[model samples]
Target chain A: MLKDFFRTFSSMIELEFRRLKHDRTEIYSRAVQPILWLAVYGPIMGSIRAIPTGNIPYTDFITPGVLIQSTTFISIFYGLTIVWERESGILKKLLVTPAPRYATVIGRAMASGIRAIFQTFIIILVALIIGVKFILNPFYFVLALVIIFFSSGGFAAISILVASFMKTRERFMGIGQALTMPLFFASNALYPVTMMPKALQYFATINPMSYVVDAVRSLIISGDLTNLWLDIVAIAIFNIIMFTLASVNFKKIIE
Target chain B: MEKAVDVRDVVKIFNKNFRALDGVSLEIESGSIFALLGPNGAGKTTLMRILTTQIGPSSGHAYVFGLDTVKEGSQVRKLISYVPQEMSVWTDISGYENLLIYSKIYGIPKEERNNIINGVLESMGLHDVSNRLVKTYSGGMIRRLEIACALLVRPKILFLDEPTIGLDPSARKVVWEKLKMFKKDYGTTIFFNTHYMDEAEIYSDLIAIINRGKIVTIGTSEELKHSVGGEILHFILSENGLHEDVLRELEGIEGIKDVVVSNSDVTFVVNDAEMILPHIMTFFNKKNIFVRRVSITKPTLDDVFLKYAGTRIDVSGRLSEVTHVRRMIRRG
Candidate 1:
């Protein structure tokens, strides 16, 4: 049974890989966004002020946080791939096949995380050239990967939840942009959470990006642990809750 | 005999309150080439979609190759390959790549996919067009590719919607030959939908004519042609006054049901054109009504369609559509 599940999962992943060959949008947006945030935004901040990020170079402190942000943003549109398929009659094609929907979901999530990993590497390479306080510690590096998988997948589930109800391409795009941009803006996108106003801080605590950004912020920005477990726990809870919701919605629409 | 497709009281209503299909029922015998003929707003596509398991019925049930479309949806889908009417080819990809993607999705073994793809492509004479992006392909090549995609699965039943919509005369002949080959080689039951009467009449073993979301008529072309019974007498009138008087007398004849007198001539509906046509012509000649043109033709399926739908069934007949077909593959 486990082997069967793995085969289905891998096939689903392979399906996405096939789609990626034709999907050119990822080459531009996923790879370029974090590099600009790091090489452009990070350097401007480090040169301008002492910054709130301890004494370390601002680029080093901000690199992982930006990487996580980009992953979440990119992954949240995993459902858009479905929307395109549904619009193109490819969804009909997929539904007719014997492959399970859960495998489709998990496989899509796998694809999203892998793409994010590649994007994160690009940003890291750009940061290294720009003299950011880069971390070579394998433990923290692995931790960064875990954070991306959890947060990116959770965001993708949310995307799937919205995409399930959409009937048109415009509606899909509207929902995708609506969820992604707000989460980015509400989190500690450009500043430390400690610097936020009281109401903003209260709102930031519940936002998912707050947890994801905080986890990456702790590992790479502060070079120390502070409430990392809370982010991990919240992300795990979000993953389960949203994944269940997405799976249910996905089944409903297809049926 | 076992049936390849059995549908009873299938219905579908869109969320926007459009009643696409209203309780459609049909049975297609195994190995028969069945043609579904309907006007633009008719429910043919909806019925096809439900049978293919791409959309579920609002009510009632359907089965393909004995597998229930709803309960055994995966199995039903496994048995059917739908070639939708639209230009569904991948514009940015080669025809070969498109076939490869669909083959993998259908879970065809690698060797078989290659063999089928090569065979189907070569049969369609599309092996030369397989390398270029589909955007550069002509209308006929694109349609051939659509058929190629559907055939990759070696399905027991093939559903083709407007499969010959854009083909030229010669390409259409090539397509018909391939369809005949497909059935002869695979014993595949073809459930085809077309507005082109020539395509349907010349190719199908059985024909069902639908109008206004209902199947008003179903039979072979010969059966439909003889359904209203008897023969048809036609007269083309010029802007001259000689032929009208005799046609007026024939309008009052006992067995005639309809008379259309336009300009200088009259058209008569009769129980037997052989019985009434010569009498009318003789009367017109004796009375000096000047018969310009007269012909005896049997009632056609086109006449039956016009009789029921109040319109002609031309593949290129322009539709100022009250509702567009669902913007899906082959307009859904």
Candidate 2:
């Protein structure tokens, strides 16, 4: 059973990779937004010191946040593909296969994570060019990669869960837009969580994206392993819950 | 011989109120091509889904090779493949890539995968275009690619829902030809659902006529046509108009089984068109109703559906005569 699950997972990832190869322009297009944030928004906000970042420069502090933001955007909109697949009959074809339902769900969620990872590479390259300093530790970088993958995966699974109930792409898009901005703003992606109101602080603490940004920031910028366990545990728990719900509800799209 | 599929009194109700399949029961013999012929909303897809284990029947049972579809769904999935009614291939990917994904999904070993994919592509006549993106291919090629994906595992039983819908006549023929070859080569039990009377009559070894969630009749094409048991005498009357009363009068004549009138066209299902044609001509002559053209045809599956289901199977307005005949049959 485990063998079958991994095979299915790898096959699905390979399928997405083939599709991505055919459309390499998407990678280039997706990099535009994060570059804009780093080059334009980061400079303007950093010069003004609009948000406190202790000793770190504002541009460097927001670099990881920008990466998480772009990753969240890519991951959350992944459900649109599911809706399209349902419309085009591809989902039906996949569901009829002998693969277990959970395998299919996780396979697709991981595929989205890989796509987000591609975007992560672009953002980090832009961050380096813009003079954002990192601690230069290979171990911290690897941990940050793992955190980005699983956090993007959890967000993608949430998107799939929404797709299982939202049959139409238009409705899914509406919900996706409503979701992405709020999740970005409620988290500490842009401003410090301490600066937020009490109600918003509660949201920031529970928001999975905040943990993702915090983990990534600590690993890459401060090289601090403090709270790294909390960050990893929180993201892991979030992924487990989201993946379970998404897999259980995956068949509902066809119904 | 063992049955390939056995569906016993299967019932599928949707949304608590709509009964899609009231009580569908039938058995398909192993290694034979079986077809479920029905009009739209006739529950053909519903029944196929149950057998494919995509959905369980609300009540009763369905089995593929004696394995309960609901309980043994995983096992049944291992032995069968399905081509759904809609276009199911991934258009953004090349045909080879699409087949490769299915081959992996079916768990064909890595070493044998290329050979099997190549074999199916060649058989489906898609080898030349296998490297091309599917969106660039014609509708027929896309469908053939979908079938090629299904054939990757060489499944024992293959189910297709509306396998050739919305294709040109030539495209439809090409699809059926490939399907026939698959059945002959592998002895796969091919079960498909279609509303095309000609397809069901020509290709299927056994045809089941389903309407409104019920199997109206099941038999070989010849048997179903024989059960209708009459020739159709069709005539288009000349400019002289005939009243409804005169048309009804023809039904009273001996040897005339049924009379249907649509505009100036008159059709009579008769015991003997040779004997009844003379009477029809004499009656038309006496009334000064000149006949423009006349032809006698063997009762087709359309007539069989009209006889048994009390409705015409094709409602696309191509066969208006059959619809009129059905209305007359319903009235009597």
Best candidate (score: TM-score): 2
Off by over 4 Å in 2: B232-296, B315-332
lDDT of 1 by residue, A1-255 (tens): 455346556665564555556655774667677788887888888788756877767777777767777888778776776666565545555555555656566555666776676667777777778776655677887897778776777787787778778866689888888887777767776677778788888878888888888787777657667689888998888888887787667765543
Candidate 2 — what's its lDDT? 0.88
Could you estimate the TM-score for every candidate?
0.79, 0.87
DockQ of each: 0.21, 0.36
Q: Candidate 2's residue-wise lDDT over B15-52, tens digit each? A: 99999999999999999999999998899999998998
Q: Write the per-residue lDDT of candidate 2 for residues A1-255, one digit (tens) a residue.
A: 998899889988898898888776776787899899899999999999878898999999989999999998898989988877776667887888898879999999888888888899889988999999988989889879988988888999999999999988789999999999999999988889999999999999999999999999999986767988999999999999999999989878788
Spell out the clash pairs found in candidate 1: B86-B330, B242-B289
In terms of lDDT, model 1 sits at 0.74
lDDT of 1 by residue, B1-332 (tens): 88898889877888858778777888989999999998666878788878878678888899887888988886677678887654555555678888876676566776787888898898777998898776677767877888888888778889887777656678888888988998999999999887778888999999999886778889988778877665778876544643455556767767677887666656667777777777776766677566668788788788989877788864554332211322233322
- Candidate 1: residue A1 lDDT (0-100): 44
Specify the poorest-scoring 10-residue window by lDDT in model 1 chain A.
Answer: A88-97
Q: Residue A96 of model 2: what lDDT?
A: 82
